[model samples]
Target: MLNGLGVWDIFLTLTTLTRGYLIWKVVNLLTRSTTGSTNVYQEICGQWVQTNTLTMDNADWGTFVRYAHRVKSIVIHNDSLFGNCKTIDVSILRALSMPPIPPASILFPQLRQLVCYDRRDEIYPFVRLLFGPKLTKVDVRLEASRSAQLAVLPSLAAWCPSVKKAELRVWRERPLGAGGINEVRALSDVVCKWRHLEQLSCGVGCLDDKAILHLGKLNSLRSLQLRISSHLTYHSVRQAEHGPLFQFLDHIHMVAIDSLSSCTSFFPLFSSLPPNITISPYAPYRSEGLCDLFTDLSVHESSGVLEDVSVEDHFQSTAPEEVFTIETLRPLLGLHRLRILSLETFYSFSLDDNALKEIGSAFPLLAELSLTADRGSNRHSKISVNGLITLLGLCPHLTSLSLTIDATRVDDIEPERRPGGGISNLNIDTLRLNDSKINHPRIVAAILFDVLPYVDVFAWEWGAHFDESDAEIYRPRWVEVQALLGAFRTVQEWRQPGFLPM
Candidate 1:
């Protein structure tokens, strides 16, 4: 047929077909590009992206918008304006105001995960519409004049039925008028609604006695962590027994307990509950009483199901009892399920060879261990590194270990030297430390290269509080760390993971 047609006509027809194919390919490319300012669609299926017009360039927003309809997750990062605004920018303010969620039929209908870091007042309402029945996870970091936490209760109370994990941060709240009552009211109401909630972290400004009592209503809660500047009491935890608080609870954490002695009768409150509990010794005056509490609770023997324990207070105690060590921990060895252990601030306890062997017999199932020292000048007592290494020999099941080493042999006293070398036959896989005090280059080198060959993850960070010049002068320690880790099975600089510089 082509032979019958003229040569010029045939060539022109072939060129037109080729051009059409090329245009189709370009359209396909454009459709595939999901990140930009403008949303894109192909027939019925499409995606959308929301971009801050003020912050993101036109091209960037275009890229995001192109895929906006398909984007099930969104993240916004911006600081607060006044540090006191109560309102937040609703997540879908722009999208819902404009196109809104498309009317389509699918098994999972709404967006899955929404993360907002904006301080604008519109965030709360935005989250309400975007996270419908289908939302599973919501993380919002907001700064408001009235406190972002005020916005959290309503959003979580309504949507948490579908959410498995939720995190909220608020700046500050002034407890006054009906507004003060509002937070407590909201928390009480929402705890009942969020039946499926598993993990939660929120900063509640003034969680008074009444509000704390209301917290026990979350019966289905498994892992609950609260960071508050408010007062807490035994009745708060006591209310959990008959109410919604401890029905399915296996893990409970309360951090920054500015005053434990203020709640003196609190720890004994959980005696009737199950054995699994974690109490951070962050409150003042936990010295001997704190350790005694752990022993008493763990003495249930058969019911001693307490597997996780963390005591972060390491300051020199006013009490006269010996500092905690593997020897002291020997009594609780009868608590068979004790596995995860963490002790911070007090790192200078002596663990003799016999104690190490006893520890091996005690915590056979132990998996994660973290021992950290306080960086303050209060570390008047010296830590025995050799003894600690010898103690590690007993923990055959140990997998994760994090130690904050003051690396210096002695501070105020004449330079009393510590053991020079590291272990050779330990089964640890991950090791992390902040060893700014140690000036010896080979200290870490000895650990990484000669010892702990089985270790996989090694990390160390210079002290953030050190003077700039000190940090620079100490920068060589980091290099030494790299060199030491390099000689081992693997090597990488330690970047604080999920840790905000305090």
Candidate 2:
């Protein structure tokens, strides 16, 4: 009787172990089928799934579909998948033709943000598949083609009523034809339906007088970006009897304009904008328009509070001549609180010693400054090494500096002496220099090391000086400079152990 009882206990223990192994095998199979090869998705069966954001390009659709249920945010560029595909595969066509899953049973049920870039025809179907009640942010860029029609933004807005931020870009290779005005009017009518939208950016030719009025009705809107096209003429925007543009400008802190047609119409409205607001234009103003803008800004009381400004010219194949002079920029002296200034031109926006001196005197609190030219031209030859050193001395608080260095005449002129004594240590964190005519790298490196010892990043654009093979030749110079900088830092730290380097 004792032997029989012992045998029965061993049999029960074997059965329990067999059942546990079978359960483990089943779980592994399920995980492999559900999450594919990515280990991050293995534990995505519960609350952990909702924390993930997925970005999918044309080749990532299979992965996207496999884990769509777990993703919370999705950024997809579907242009390559459908835009030029003249013939769709029969299998894919059949899959797309099938009715969308019920809202209750849909994939990406927790998706809150959707960013899509595709042609108009492809964008609609892709958006339809991923639409969810919880989606609150949508950014769509529709590549403009002559065959493509304007996307009805209001209809898109209707699909996602909860969207608080919406950015729609419809860029065309060519200017819109005769019906562009009517298309813009339709867009104006549709945007008013987005009562919950707090931020909206619709690219050029979308903002007309009537549209601005409709946008004004969106009391929830706190930020807006509109491209200044021909539709926004000086007379139309300024002569408005009772439009909300002025009232809307009063509430927003940031305004960005793209492809500005002229500075005359835009600058006059500067007084209406709130004192704290910053204006950033995507394209450069023409030479004449920039002069007018500076002239107007010189006397404006609110210009003092304008802290950030970016000016770039329209990119062209042939380089343009100097667009601005020191005399033209003298008007900007009124901007006392300016901290950030960027002036980028195609090839020839000349800055001389006197101009650098004027800029240094004008904005004493400048922390970030950039004066970049795409290709070095004859106009850039006027900027010498002395001017740059003087400019650096004036703006002691500068943290980032990008300048075009024309070191052709450095040997002829002596380095400017700092008024107090030797070179004062610059707090510059990043230094970008372009077209250094100086052939010797050590001399260039030594000059920079003396003034900006604490610089963390050094970007030298050796345009014609060095080719791919010559990269090895320059490596020693860079290494030497870095070693010197490291030694300087070590000594400084030893001298003042408690002091923090910015």
Candidate 3:
């Protein structure tokens, strides 16, 4: 028996020693590979090349150029690198320069996309270099001087015949005289020539009904986004108005309209939109107009085909305003096929238990729902624990949810009747509580866990005015709730083999 025990001890010692040696060798090998100039090329060869300026000496420049073909993307702020290489094979390039490199020096044979934000004087030369057949995408934002010449869109079309996507923004350095309707006509003429272009975004301060009609002729266009000056008007409701622009929207799958004016009218045009389409409007409209817009959408036959709806007040403001009321949203409930709904407001929006119930009952197919207040805004949302429970019970198909509710009065309210009883199975994968004002986060977390025990991702943040010093008072309660949730998950996994807990 003593000899048998000695043999087992020897086996254990040998196994441990072998493992230690292997671990030591691995550590040494990793250390050597990561800690020297010899590995620099290996470290950066496959990565995106980012440089402030090309100030490296000849040796370093040569080394970078030798490995330039391995770079998939590069961003250069200065133009000094233009002369260092005869050829580069980057796929994407972004150059921010005051003066563009000479056209002759630009040599990116394999480039597919290019983004250049430079002065008007440099844009021509920079664009001339990117006029190859392989270039499919281009984004150019030019700063125009007082004497700056307008870039001819025809020239761009002639050079970039195979370009599929383009975004152009021209801003004058100083407030100059506005371009006339003639300029708009000229631009439309140039843009209509791109037969291969599938997507186009332009902010040229001269797009109107005529330009839109001209662009409608492009049979290959799948997506269109236009940023036009607010001064341009389209009176689609007028009896005398008849344009091909409305017909153009019928074939396009996605359209985004951005107007610089605080209030731009598109009601007349939107009424005739395609039944199956995605529309994003970045400009804010008047509250009354917005209500009218929703009412119109609800009654339209195309409302059933609407898949994504987002209303965000992009301007930063502190006080919540009454932008969207429960009554205004009541009409939107008719959109039964809606899958994604996002409404972020700067002002306090009224959302009661009844409204939540109506939403869940109306949009049974909703996969993502985000009802959040703008960041830094003070919100007084009227959502109780019972209301949230009702919503979860009704929306069984929901996978992602974001809610900003004022739960300060949760303790005062009675516990929900049949709390989490209706939910037989939970499909929720992500939940985010924005600026939770709940008296106890643990209680809220527990309530959520009871309904969505399998939720893979959970995030919560306190209200803007929450005091951190008082966290100690709530630490024990949070730990208790977490322990209960953990045990619940463990039991669930044990009962159902192969169950993954989050």
RMSD of each: 12.4, 11.4, 13.5
**Top model number, lDDT:** 2
lDDT of 2 by residue, 128-210 (tens): 66666677887877644422335545455556678788776666665333226555655566566567777877754355665
The models' CA-based lDDT, in order, is 0.48, 0.54, 0.51
Any idea how many clashes model 1 has? 45
lDDT of 1 by residue, 362-461 (tens): 7778777665443321132233344345556556577777654445542232224322233354567566654434566666455444446666433335
Q: Which pairs of residues collide in candidate 3?
A: 320-347, 321-347
Q: Please give the range of 10 consecutive residues that has the lowest summed lDDT in model 1.
A: 20-29
TM accuracy, model 2: 0.68
Error of 1 at 255 (Å): 2.5
lDDT of 1: 0.48
Candidate 1 residue 431 Cα shift, in angstroms, is 3.8
- How many steric clashes does model 3 contain? 2
